[model samples]
Target: MATLLHIDSSVFPAAGSASRAVAETFRKAWEEQHPEGTVIYRDLATDPVPHLTADAHTAGFADPSAHTPEQAAVFAERLKLIEELEAADAVLIGAPMYNFTIPSTLKAWLDNVILVGRTAGDSPSVKGTPVTVVASRGGSYAPGTPREGYEYVQNYLSAVLGDMLGLEADFIVPELTMAPQVPAMAELVPLFESSRERAHQDATVKAKTLAERLAA
Candidate 1:
């Protein structure tokens, strides 16, 4: 069975909010499809992984052949994140857009995952891994519509990550058509449940097929 990494960058928990609700639906669907698979959850908001420091940044940008003791720790953490991604056949990122961008919490998580030589640009460890990015937004941003200009957030994920991975990228974005004016308590619950359910199921099927190939 493949090991899955579930990254939840929102501040909310499963019990009381829309972002968490969406994340759950996404995770559950994958779990359902890959019952034999394993999942490791990392919630950034509640228990944040530290952001990059000059030390951390230099460590990542540094060459792998030689690392100092302190630098190695930072490098090791990055590799751990990469290992988690590489070990899994797929990845699920639950990130809600904030101000036409992803959350800083999620950004912090990305800062860890996107290592210079490991995941992208020149020295990648794994190629062709499937990734599903679920983005929740308060407003609408569909391609070619009037609101299309607002859709740069998803585009950024695609361009940056796709260039890095050289693989297909699937995005599941749910916009709150009635946000701000309508309380999330009423309008967001269904959307969250449906998206999560679908994502979980999708991953399960993919994992099984990949597992079979690997077993061969």
Candidate 2:
């Protein structure tokens, strides 16, 4: 059966999180297409993985047999995360922008799973796997917008997830998410609604399409 590695790093619940809400939509569509498929779900906000440590970092380059007890223990945890990524056929991430970048939880997860020789180098184990990231943000950062240069979420992920890991990365962005709540941005609420709706539609279509492609 197919497998999806679904990760959500939103601190808020689905009702309050644009990324979580859209990610759930995509997951539902994916599950509908593959009734027997497996979804390895990780709620990073609730169960955040450990941040990378020196022991874990050095162990990746050292031989397993030579690892100290501390390195061994930390590296074992890292391997579990890397193996999970290797086992997945597809990946979905809810990367809501937090202070102009992905949540620290999501970054920690990446730090754990990314190993030099196995998951990040030329022959990455999960190379070419499709990853869909729901990159939600509070303000508009589309090209030509005043804050376009501040759009580090997508740009950073593209480099890390695509250039480094070699995954086929795609993004479904829902911007201006704060317009409805921020009085200063109240005029952009309509744009937020439109973006949110389009994000849902994109998630649904992409989920179904990818599912069908995998089945074929």
Tens digits of lDDT, candidate 2, 79-137? 99998899999999999999999999999999998888899998988899999999999
Assess every candidate by TM-score: 0.77, 0.99
* C-alpha lDDT score of every prediction, in listed order: 0.67, 0.96
lDDT of 1 by residue, 43-139 (tens): 8888787776666678887776677888887777767766777787667677777778887877766677776666777866556766667776766
Which candidate gets the maximum TM-score versus the true structure?
2
- Model 1 residue 193 CA deviation in Å: 11
Best by lDDT: 2
The TM-score obtained by model 2 is 0.99
